[model samples]
Target: MNYDECHTVKTICGPHASCHNTAGGFFCLCHTGFAQLSGKTNFTGYGAGCQDVDECLQQPCGPHGVCINAEGTFLCSHMTPPMTSHLQTTLSPFVHCLSNLLKDQSIIDNCFTKRLQQPPADQFCSLINSTLAFARRMCEQKGEYRQKSASVTLKDVTSFGNKFVADGSGVESATVFLGAMENFATLAALASPTQELKAISSAHLDLDVRVIDVTNRRFLAHERLTLRAKNDTLDIYMKTVTEEQQTGASVVVFLSYTDLRSLQRGEFVTEGQPQSHLLTSSVVSVVIGNRRHRQLRDGVNITLSHTSQTQGSLSDWRIFCVYWNHSPSSSHWSPEGCEVIQSNGTHTTCGCQHLSSFALLIATSKVTPPANRLQHHGILPNPAPIQNVLQLRYRMV
Candidate 1:
């Protein structure tokens, strides 16, 4: 009988396919965003099922955004539509902290700002800690803001770090510096090309940005990011690795700090060595996405160069790769997750399981020696004299 085959047999079509009644017959049509495996437009038999069509291959997202394929759809992170609207009152704290850091100023400007309205010495930490607090908040907010860079020089950066360390503000410049790197990282990563190398440079700091395509490890030349300052260099390797469950565009940023020597004086990180000293005055900060607060299964390797200096004597110093750690009571450097891979008089290389601001420290047991016993007793030697030959790697957690 010429009965409606499409309506009589409710299960006429396979999943994701619809049965269309025709002249005394019925045809199967794949649903939107799906295609029949056989590539036939119309069919009556269930020989094939509908398959998800990868719209991303067609670049449906746009010109500026990267398309991410899904089971039946796709997504795009467009660089347009300024994320400023998404920011709320809660972001005020970050705005305040970051605005203070982005000011372009020379050492003289910082020193003579308002002779009658001088800021507290601890303003360095106060500003830095606030920015870091915002970074911690970003893990939850994932919000993006305006693009900004600090205009201070390496000399001024050194001066601020020293000022904070001297003020005993209970926060390390490493922590502050780390916060600032991620702060800029968030800005750079939020709206970036999926597979392109981007370099932003100014007098104060330089940044490298790369967005990873998870589907392709060799997506572009961005798998490694390197930043070079006047006399220092930072290399961030394996920027593509991320947690297995983590499924977002991985962005890597490598930053050079102004100066870390000031913060090193009081924030020694060696265990049981209260008098430990940082060998090189150089310190650097980096972040891959927002994973700085946790450890990565496949850790990232970083290489850093040390300052050049000639010393008359050397001591039995141990090299350590450390990151800044903060607590309610105090802030210090910690080498818990890092190990020295290689080191020389001028550089050190370290491998760390976490992602954070990294630096190198050389520790030697400090002790008082009487002049009478200088030649007789087993007295401790001088603190390790590390010349500019230094390269380092360190992570978070």
Candidate 2:
């Protein structure tokens, strides 16, 4: 049993350090607010570079609070709120300014883009949507399950923005994904299954959270719940009915986001006209768990998986299954309640019926772009065979 990759070995560790793998070899450490400079804690070879310690020298936020620091880390901010996280003093300065604007170096070399850079990655997804609008107000903090829910408040704040992700919830049980496309509130935890059985998963969401009856919310009669996810891209089937106790998690949720399209680029209108799609899959959000499975008479059967087929056109890419709306005036992505049923080039089989947040767009170009220019993708017209559909178009130059 031989292996490698202890970070591709180039002096192994030095500048600000960070290896960590342990038990079967691996260790470097020294990032969070850094140290090393030789005041050693672990070393070897080109090991040792980290320094930045001053966590505000020592004011750890006592006298009227306002630390700021920032390098390894430090940012108490304005202060006076902690009756128990006044939402970490109003979203911890947008997670410490998106973890220090991704350690800026020209946004770590133009935001490690993954492609489809809309509106020039809208100022890097508007600085990661200021942590996705406080991760959608921590998923609308509904009802009660306290202990300061959220697996016990950000479960040891495990690496954000820099992208590691871990939550370890309050009562115990963590692993909350808040790095890319992070929203839907630090994903309220639930691993407890004290028999009454069914599924509810993570790693990258796997569905079917069966077992209802929180006082006969009904469903254990002929039980029906099926969900599939673990990479192969996507596949989900739904036909659930509730009622079954031993309760813990049943606010009914089944999320799967690989970048809730961060902030969806090229958002083809749908049901309101204006088309020109290209999302091609990487968004699956089905929040069903009663109120009659969240308004489903018979729908919720998604099956997307088309990140490409040589990039566009299976009869002009047409697909659009959309959802995720708003109102205080208006938000967007509204295909009215979805229904693609079948598509080709790779996959597409939706049937939604009102849940929330979903995506599939694809129809890349038969031109269509007006509607105040879909909030600027540089007013369209680059048309040379869908230029790989908005070639990761994030423009701020």
Candidate 3:
């Protein structure tokens, strides 16, 4: 039997469909991108015709970009560089400003106003070290490790005038610098630390001066003095001279300062004035001799010694003075002047049992007191006044 003759069937077109035959089975089908309308079929009826599917209507690309329909799948293309994220974009301005400030702050107008109250300590250390380095450079320019044993003489000590005039507190608080010296030359390298200074001779002349005010209080000037020496250790004779010292013997061995008596005392400046000395500690000058820690006797006048045997840069041979106060609170006045009197029912006020009662009040008289107390200063004269205030009275029947 022939296949065509065995099963012969006539196909009729239905609604919204095209007919296809395969392996003796016939089915209704629609073209690609079109859906078949189900059930009955007529030209314009429900299943009679295929509907044209709109690819753009679906909008599969989300809201950010455009979606293109291809043969089998859809292609999503960004309309613009994917728009910056709202969250990240919103913070861009803040990040930019912070980064700009971190760069050269010259453009920032309020940089100084926002500066920290105190610069880091490391900053001060760097500044001081730099200044020392400059001095070391000057030393290297002259010579290195010039040793003078018998009679050491130094010259040109005036070159380091500014360093010598620094305040005592600055010098004492400065980090100790240890310099690496050249073997033959006394001149130290700029990068090295400055520790012990070299001298020319064994019996060197040491000159020291303390600035004493009218009240007999002494202040220290810069402690490190410029001196020329042949070795790291020894005594050397030095003379302080200006550029003019070359022609004359005007090498001043000592600088004598006499305090001028000022009539101003206990006078505070007007309010709103800039603070001239905030956070700065009061500094005192202390003289140290051959001993490392021993202080020279008070009231001793330091002067220059005249001697014949001297050679080399005698100008830099000035005594190295050290600045220090007894303690951090050394500026506090000792409780000696003030007095306090206690009050009782009979006498109303009397001296307390302590010897310092009177001293406390006197010492504190100058200070603007925060409260009403017998002692205005740091010292307390008597505890009886406080006791009297605490006593209680009761009515009896």
Candidate 4:
């Protein structure tokens, strides 16, 4: 080889007999049987070595596996598919994906990381609670739509001045207003005595109550209703019982009407105070404590107040009507006809007969007061009696 030519390749004195060339220098390179290993060659003085190249980036393997190039050598390896996907492919629909993943937790966690972290845990829990509370308010609002008299105010649980605040240690006050509002729904344990509710206004014939509260000792929040009755019609001003609370609290409520009639007979067949028909239905109770709260471990108790107009012509009747299982599912109270169970003052159970849903053939009679009575006793009649045969259907469930 030429001594001055940079392009010439010449063999060095080292035992490795390879030759290579560079600018103004000639060096030994790998022979046909070998290739230079990586980092083996460096330019120092006149005797440096040539480094091997990694062919892995060039994908030297059959394109099905990884290629790792080493000094004068290389290796190829096949990648194994994930076990989950492997089973999915092999077993088709019969694959037991959970069993495989449970045996290996890391694989499952890595796969689901992005989906699971979309919403933080705290935000998820808060969203759930908010949804439930919103649903309760919506149901209550719908029920209040049917009230005839007396304004109802929906109170926020946080708006009350005397609300309970939990301190991880112990409750500061023995009693706190978990929530308070007009037409608020309450629920107590089903076993509690139903007759313990406070009567806001009681009329022998008709009644009107301004404020009613029923907080039982059971720590449940139930319904408390303030009502105004006119003529033979009753206006309800209260929230609809929520689906969850309805089954837990059952009470005996009373509703009084002067006469009971049957469409088949078309005549007044009976007259008296029916206690069974009056008391069996549950009335709305006011809940003063949070049913969901724990430390006020005991349920809440409430008080109710009523306003009576003794001088009015329709103030004598204080009646509470009971409509049981009123919904589209109720087949007993049909539009064509329904049964009216009447109980006289003397009998515990009243007679039952079929009548139209809107059939009220009862006489428009009046209750005569005592001749020597000093106070003016007024009897409120049904303001909107079902006389025109406009039969309405209600479900039981």
**Number of the predicted model whose lDDT against the real structure is largest:** 1
Candidate 4 lDDT over 279-332, as tens digits, reads 211122122211221112211111111112222332233222122112222211
Clashes of each: 15, 20, 41, 51
Clashes counted in candidate 4 amount to: 51
Candidate 3 lDDT, tens digit per residue, 1-397?
2233112432233332455545544455543334544533323232344543334358655664343222112223332232233433643222222212122112111222122234334543443343333333332322331111111111222122223223221422221210110100111110111122342121221222211111112223211222211111111112111111121111112211111011001111213232111111111111211111122121111111111222221232221111111223221222122122222212111112111100011111233322223533322233221111111111100
- State each model's CA lDDT, in order: 0.47, 0.40, 0.23, 0.24
lDDT score of model 2?
0.40
Off-target runs (Cα >4 Å) in candidate 3 are 1-122, 134-158, 161-289, 296-323, 326-397
Single out the weakest 10-residue window by summed lDDT for candidate 3.
177-186
Rank by lDDT, highest first: 1, 2, 4, 3
CA displacement after TM-score superposition, residue 385 of candidate 3 (Å): 46
Shift in Å, residue 295, candidate 1: 0.8
- In the range 1-397, model 2's lDDT, one tens digit per residue, is 4344365675577675666655566667665555775677766545555666656668776664434343343333332332232344544433333332222222212332222232454443444433433433432334221112233222211123213212211110011122222222222222111223223234433333332323223333333343333222222222232233232223344434444333355345665776655666655555432122246554455555666643345545356677656433445566786656555566555666556656677565554422211111111111111111111010100
* TM, every model: 0.48, 0.26, 0.20, 0.16
Quality of model 1 by C-alpha lDDT: 0.47
What C-alpha lDDT, on a 0 to 100 scale, does residue 79 get in candidate 2? 24
Candidate 1's displacement at residue 126, Å, is: 6.2
Q: List model 1 lDDT by residue over 1-397, tens digit each.
A: 6778778877787765678787878788775556877788777885355766666568765564434333333333433221232342544333333333332122112322222145537455454543344333322233422222112222233333334434443244445455554544544343332223323234334443444544334333334444344334444444334434133345555655544444555577556455556556356666655342456654555555555551212224566678776654776778877766555555555666776667776666544321221111111112122233222221111
Ranking by TM-score: 1, 2, 3, 4
